[model samples]
Target: MTADIAADILVIGAGIAGASLAAELAPHARVVLIEAEDMPGYHSTGRSAAFWHETLGGPLVQPLTRASYPVLEAGGFLKPRASLEVAEINGLPLLDKLASEFAGTGVGLARLDHDGIRQWVPRARPILVGGMLESTGADIDVAGLHGSVLAAFRRAGGMLETGRRIDRVERIDGVWHVQAGDWHTSAPIIVNAAGAWADGLAAMAGAKPLGIQPMRRTIAQVRVTTDDVPDHLPLVIDIAGSYYFRPEGPNRLWLCPHDETPVEAGDAAPEEIDVAIAIDRFETVTDWKVAAVERKWAGLRSFAPDRLPVYGFDPVVDGFFWFAGQGGIGIQTAPAAAMLGAALLLGQPMPDAVAAIDPAPYAPDRFVALAQR
Candidate 1:
């Protein structure tokens, strides 16, 4: 109950990826998860929009959704929440392209005329909308899903050390000696899952830096007319992804601009300009005006240069593994991401289902390959 002191596999972050990997690896190995904050998921994972749309991720990451669906379905982490993306006059071409890509992923969508937009979100103005409605997207049980992984990890003999903000790491006798405050932990296998802080950790481990940048994304909540907006309304968005708003309660809606501004890793805060942009866009698309802001916050969504998640062990380091650069798909793809980690750590054959998709596109070495040019 005090501290793990050490583990065979040491995970450096306590967000979705780290937590899920810890849960998956705990049953087979001695696993210890370390969090800089007093609680897990204090950053991006805690501030997610909690959507589970398989068609939204990159081509390389689509298979992760396919692989993770079984666990999500079995774990009851998803519930159908009707959703649509509206393309305005300026967004028609992009909307068409997105719809084509979505269709390729086996996601059912309808090319909605202005009238169709009003049918879904009643407040939506028909005159300026032309978009596609992705009929199969769902809302996620974020807290439940994240909690389940933590619960499973603990139940499987994994150790969790919270507020153990790591200060230093050094290779002594080819073993990593990690220091958090005065306490020390040594592990042969160290997973770089510190989310926004991943690059810093990699630097400490003497690994080459990957151009991982943490971007601040903000969200705000506003009151909606109860009778006009149903509690089960689909998540409505701009076809260009400039803004999105979804039902939070019978009379409340959550909204955010798809803003991505680079920032240092820490507790992200919502900006007034970002909030104004979302409200302005919401008013432009729908007749509803955001007169009151109930709440507002922000989170860091880190991304690699290619915008794909970096997985697999570092080529130069013997025991260091990369599991960062998840961007915004961390929760939806956690199951497969953790399984991928497990396979690499155990030095076992990749699961046939996952291997069929080929993980090389997302490997850490891909960055190395790009730099050679």
Candidate 2:
């Protein structure tokens, strides 16, 4: 078929990362966003737990999450939903340490005694001795966010191609020639935002591999035989990372064992053992009986060796950008991350939203030094 397509900036994924960045840059550049899947966000973006909490992704990611809050708030994609971190007697000290560490970070976490913890999460078993509440946490509308971003990109004259899986990439006379299926695309700049397949995409572009590992996370929706399940239930997580759950709806709960099994990039599915583990853990956390496993699914969260998102152009490959390794926090940090990525790609100053964040920690050059050692 050999259809020739050209763009000033060719983004190699249509997930949240690619869509957000394309939306940010489409107004200024000729952008083309391509997806291997039949539709955008068929992986992690669609399978996300769909919560936006300031402290969910750790201290390094908090800044990006905070920067993105305004956009999400303005877009009406955020709905108020608090998060509770419950701890057993042995885990109480860890909760205190976490509260102390985040003291002045603007992610206020209030220490909750046993009574307060129960008040927040009434269904929690008596094993919980203490807890902390992130009052600013909220549920994010993932689909809405992704759709809005892609719609804006298209409105700004960006081209979107689905079912085009890039198999070959080569730089020819200052232009990147990318071949996907029967279609061909050429651009001066190529953005690698292929999520779990990021390293593979970079390798295809002749860029250094960043050792991005895709880890599988499982989640299941179970109907609980309990009268306490409420639509307003806060997201309850164990301080020790054992399990987490929140009300999917009245009499229903969404739960995960907080598993991070290392795996390759592809369409992820929930393992039966993992599902059983999640249910088993949930039983220990709450007295609610699981009536049935309504549904279960799994998704991949890719991380760099340092477990931080990588952004900026490849230090060794000209016009090739690194915008992967966002892990589980990509959706919450999309607005700020995309802004920063587009700014760097365009050789512009950092946007005010993420100006305070230092880009050095996420630069691809960090791996270059590591690889040399």
| Cα RMSD, model 2 | 1.5
Candidate 1 colliding pairs: 82-234
What are the per-model numbers of colliding residue pairs?
A: 1, 0
List candidate 2 stretches off by more than 4 Å.
1-3, 371-373
Q: Which lDDT values do the candidates have, in the order given?
A: 0.85, 0.91
**lDDT by residue for model 1 (236-338), tens:** 8776778888987767788899999999988999999999998888888788766588999999999999999998899897789999999989998998988
Positional deviation of residue 185's Cα in model 1 after best superposition, in angstroms: 0.6
Predicted structure 1, TM vs. truth: 0.95
lDDT of 2 at 62: 88
| Weakest 10 consecutive residues of candidate 1 by summed lDDT | 1-10
Tell me the tens digit of each residue's lDDT in model 2 across 1-373. 2339889999988999999999999999999998999999998899998789888777888899999999999999999999999999999889978887787897878888888987877767888889999889999999999999999999999999999988899898889999987789899999999999999999998998999999999999999877678777899989999899988877998989999999989999999999999999889877888999999999999999998899999998999998999998999999999999999899999988899988888899998888799
Tell me how far the alpha carbon of residue 319 in candidate 2 is from the true structure, in angstroms, after superposition.
1.0
